[model samples]
Target: MTPFRLGVLVNPLAGLGGSVALKGSDDVAEQALALGAEPKAQQRMLQALSLCRPHFNNIEFKTASGSMGADLLEQLGVTAQVLHQLEPEAVTTADDTTAAAAALLDSGVDLLLFAGGDGTARDICSLLEARGRSDRQVVLGVPAGVKIHSGVYGITPKASGEVVALMAQGELVSSMMAEVRDIDEVAFRQGQVRAKHYGEMRIPEALKFVQAVKMGGQEIKELVLDDICAEFIERMDSDCQYIMGSGSTVAAVMAELGFDNTLLGVDLIDCDGVIASDLTASQLLEQIDHRPTKLVVTLIGGQGHLFGRGNQQLSPQLLRHLGADNIIILATKSKLEALEGRPMISDTGDPELDVALAGWYPIITGYHDEVLYPLQ
Candidate 1:
């Protein structure tokens, strides 16, 4: 039997700004480094590959040289054929990514698995689209970027591996065309997000494993928020700390209460008013320590992700502390219908927690309207 041909690529600088609150890691790699931002793409890619190790004997891995691809696989005891070589002491760039993707395209690989964010997705998709081969190849992404607005990536690294394993086993892994979205990083860092579709690529259809393209939060109806805010305000506890997640829907709740809110950052609120603005994971933990806390979050429009998209401040540990009962989900009826019956999802980066959050939950859609939706 012929081994499954898989191409691996990694953007080593991806996700360098996530923990440091840079919003994105596009051109500010230096600043992120100055702020002690470390490499995350490699570690995340390793997690995906480690999960795929069970099928190592049945797959042939092809990748770029050194840190871009081959080194990490080698570290995992999996040999990968190197197709492109980087100059000594040279930093990899978009050029390197396209060159490697082109080589893999010609190598007749079954799938192209990349580790990076939306920019990396655009690179590969642009290269393939230029060659008119974008529709012919199957691609999957390991989420390792600060901004992952693209639909090509899996919800998490381990989920990416699950898709690979299914494909390798000759199982029924369907394929579909998904958008490769990108955002203006400059505007993003400045607390503005401008997401646009670069192009579409062939992605494996594993709804549970692959994430949908991020929907703009501004699409929600303002009137619906009024209702949600009323309901939320009525239930507010004077002593409980409210960790509000990022999104316009949640922002409405803040505005309704006359509290200033960061449109794209996590905030903390209490009965008094805004406690802290645009907080980090550490800051949130510090404020919520030994106190009753409720996480108020709104889902991304079309993606249906409850966590692990842009709101990394609500880390796995934070969600675990808040628990399921204390989570308040707010969304418009349009947003829920946009999913077309798909379940709400959370890739908190903790598989166990993800499972715990996979059951059904009631979503606050309006003032007196609540609907139970499956969260997977």
Candidate 2:
């Protein structure tokens, strides 16, 4: 059997601005780092590739040199052909991403699995478009960036790996063209959103795993949100620490409580008020350790992802510590209906934890209204 050639690329600075409230990591990678932002793209890439380990023999890996790709593969004990090399001491830039993409595409890999956010997608998309190979080449993204408006990414890192593993095992996986969209970090930080379409790229059509382009704007049903917030506020336990997950739905809960919210980052709050704002994975773990904690999360509008989308701060360890029973999912009935019967996904990176989280749970949709929903 001809081994499936998989090209891997990692934008090391991706998602560094997220937890620190920088909105996006584009030009301020250094500022984000100075504010204590840790590089997460590599770790996220690890999560996806770890799942591909069992199918290693069936796959041929090719990647860029150093932190861009080879480092993680080396950590996994997988030897990959290095098609592009980078200066080990220099910071990675968009040019490096494009160069790596060009090399990988030229190598005739079956699939290009890159890790980064929307900007990274644009880099790869531009390269493919320049060569007029956008339709012929198949690529997939592991969501590691702060702004992920692109449809080329999997809903989670593990989801990306799952798609690759299926292909490695000789399963038939369809391909489709997905749009690439990105927002202006300048406007984004100023509390204004300016999303623009960049281009589209071909990707595997794993609908269950690949996310749709993020649904922009706020929820139109204001009253539905009011009722959901009412129900959540009414049920708050004074002794319990609430780990507020990101999303407009969850933000409404914080608003109703008269507390400021991190719309795209995790927050730790209690009945009194905000305990901590914009916490990273380690900070979150430190604060919630051994406490009676509950996670208030909502699904990504069009993606139907309950975890591993924007809120990577809720690490697998944290989710396991909180236990499945401690989670409170909030969503509007209309949002649930948008899925058209697909189960909400729990791509928390840990496949075992994701499976353990699968089951029917009551989703609070309004004041005194709870609907039973399945989370897979």
Candidate 3:
């Protein structure tokens, strides 16, 4: 079997500055003191290394220096083949990120896996777009920042580890969305919550999903869409597994099914009930294949992304398990109106897969009320 090339990038300063900023302490030491964060970027990198290292005996982990990208790989008992970075004074910003990522993409790696927040993801995504390398090749994200907009992440660092473990096995995964919860930092500092769209990234959306947090000043009803989704899920065949997607809408399926859900996170469900706690693509597929199954999902409130936003746990293998026909979308009239002609955005970064999901899909609003909305 041909070996797959994996690229690793670490923004040692990813959450470093977030601690001082009102965005919450993205800095590990400061976040550890604040008790909200676990100083996770480094730990997450080590975890990904542990998972990826054992699988790729002939593989090389190329990175940048000084915890910027390649340095962290060295700490993980891995060696960096090339050095690409600038002075520390010039390294604090994400500007070096795009150039460094471009360098890796040029190396012809099969995949690139990096650890950082949404800012890092946007830089990489933009770089990939600029280089026209965002197609075919895949990228995975290790959660390490205050906010992650790239749909290419799992619900947690460990879950990200699990994804790399399976992907290294050369398994197929589904494209997912990465949503960086938009927040008005200036207004937030003034004691107001103003959250809006930051950007989107494409990753593998897993059954165990991360729910998009309702940004500041938003009074979103967690139940409106639930009421609608539950009505439809109740009609599903209990013998068939139901691969539920992320969002409060799909959470209603769990509520109606008599199971607990992580309101703003993703969960897996089927005839047996909740399959697992936040599954990546590979995990979901290992459970859903060969069994009659369907997927129940919903669109993002304002952005209206049906797939690949805030749902990185999904892998390509999972999407094939349920097939597109088995997928269900639940949305409220208000949520639909919020889109206002903006096409349902998908940044799973797979152009062919993105086009495959394009078409008019059936959206169930409430019991007995449904509409065919275009996913394009």
TM-score against truth, every candidate: 0.55, 0.55, 0.48
Candidates sorted on TM-score, descending: 2, 1, 3
Give the top-scoring candidate (TM-score): 2
lDDT of 3 by residue, 178-297 (tens): 454534445655777766554554454333212233332335455455557656866778777666777776776677778878665556666667777676666776777557777777
> How many clashes does the backbone of model 2 have?
0
How well does candidate 3 match the true structure in TM-score terms? 0.48
Candidate 3 residues lying further than 4 Å off, grouped into runs, are 17-21, 24-40, 88-91, 133-136, 177-181, 205-376
Could you give candidate 1's per-residue lDDT for residues 94-180 as a string of tens digits?
Answer: 788888889887775778899999989999999988977676467899999988999999999999988888766544345667899
Best by lDDT: 2
Which pairs of residues have clashing backbones in candidate 2? Answer: none
What TM-score does candidate 2 get on C-alpha atoms?
0.55
